[model samples]
Target: MPINLLYSPECLEYREAGHPDSPERVATIADFLGQKKAGRFLLPGKCKEEDLFLVHSEEMVERVRENSLPYDPSTPNIRGIYDYALLSCGAAEEACRLAVGGETSFSLLRPPGHHAGSKRAGGFCYFNSMAVAVKKIPGEKRIAILDIDGHHGNGTEEIFREKEGIIYVSVHQFPAFPGTGSVSFANCYNFPVYPGSSSSTYMKKFMNALSVIAGFSPDLLGISAGFDTHRTDPLLDLPLKDSDYYLMGREISSLNLDTFIVLEGGYNVKTVGNACYCFIKGIGKEKHGQETGKRI
Candidate 1:
């Protein structure tokens, strides 16, 4: 089967002036993924309140609806932010749904969700969309989340750190923003890289992650794909290239997973789109481990 991708217009409402994260990232990716050659792509449906409640606490959901400040000190407040957040969460859920139903899918959602924990909403995120989808997937299955963002995926770790079935792995710049991936949580894997990391560094960490995940044998793989690791990205000091994402995508696809990729973090708009294009090409043109049943 071919890979599927999900996107929505609501993602555009998330505006951060003078910041790297912007709607241009979504527009570029969507336009590329929606191209005629890409077999499966979708404009995701709106996520319901119940779906949002799955990962976040009721209090947190209500708080976001009632009151949400700027997505952190970095970005300014935008109008109708709450509605956009709901759609982003919904789009992530749609991605998971397609992946679980035997199609690989990606959610190009922004105001990314990995940073938002069960109760808190900061770090340019208002909802824990990845967590919500992971928790709600059908069947008793183990899910592995590979977060390759420049900064730590603090919210995801906090939500699933104590759990056993979920394998949460992250490779990020240490002593950066929201530093929390260094300490090992139960079934949690982490790689805190030095300031300057390159393709070799990323590949090494990915291989290590593969070794760690081989034992876990996840039913589905959820990738928090971020471009903030790109060398040009001002967020961190990781020196990554566009081709790096192709290798990363091919490696993850080689795992033969029912993959659900969610847009996590990426600042520079130009590289983000190019990186995404390469990733999709890798997922489509590259094939490995042809045998396919339900994963895990």
Candidate 2:
């Protein structure tokens, strides 16, 4: 099965001049993936305003809707941002829906979530797209969220901190923006790696973290896929190359569980598409010593 890629042209409407989370990130990746004929391309439908309430407060939802001014420091309240945020969440919701049906899907979303919480938007995010989607999926199955963004998914962590049947794992650059996730939790495990870390170093840490996920024996896997860990990203410092993403994808695929990925953070426009393409291809590859199921 081809990877179900959920995307929408409306996502490009949430543009802010000269911002790292510019609309071009999704536009560029969507075009690149299209040219590659990478997967089953799709346009996401709209999500209800009530869906937004699943992961965000009504006050926060109204704030993004009525106030066109920037609520977060770096996240611009660009024109049409409210509609675009809902659209992005819809994309993620669609991906999760596909995953629930034993198919793998990826949501090419933005203003990248993981930074936005229940009450406010931060780090270029307005809505917790994955959170909203995860909540909508009908299941009591154990879910594991592996966030490999360069920065800790502070908002995602906070939103689901006390929730049961879910384990949140994050590997991020230490002392970075938002500055949380230093300590581990009962359900959340965080690995704060040092800056300027090599790819091999990251791989070791990631592998170790994977053991934890494996032990959790989750019925489903959700990836907060962030390519900003690449060394060239303008936002943070991590020396991961494109090959690293492929290796990470391959490793994740070894688990052989139904999985869905949501776009998180990656600012290096030049390499972001390559990184995503590599990871998708890696996850789509066959895994040995295990009977394979349809992944994408």
TM-score of each: 0.91, 0.95
Best by TM-score: 2
Candidate 2, residues 205-229, lDDT tens digits: the string is 8998799999999988889998889
In angstroms, give how far residue 276 of model 2 lies from its true place.
0.6
User: Candidate 1, residues 1-296: lDDT per residue as tens digits?
Assistant: 56677877767866657666678877877776667355566788767888877778888777778765534664345667677887887888888988888788888877788889888887877888889888878778888998888888999988888786788998888878887777665778898887876669767987888777767888888888887888888788887887877787777777777788888887776677777777776775444335444342
**Superposed model 1: Cα runs more than 4 Å off:** 68-71, 74-77, 288-296
Model 2, C-alpha of 137: deviation from truth (Å) = 1.3
> Roughly what TM-score does model 1 have, to 2 decimal places?
0.91
Q: Any runs in candidate 2 off by more than 4 Å, and if so which? A: 68-71, 287-296
Clash count list over all predictions: 0, 1
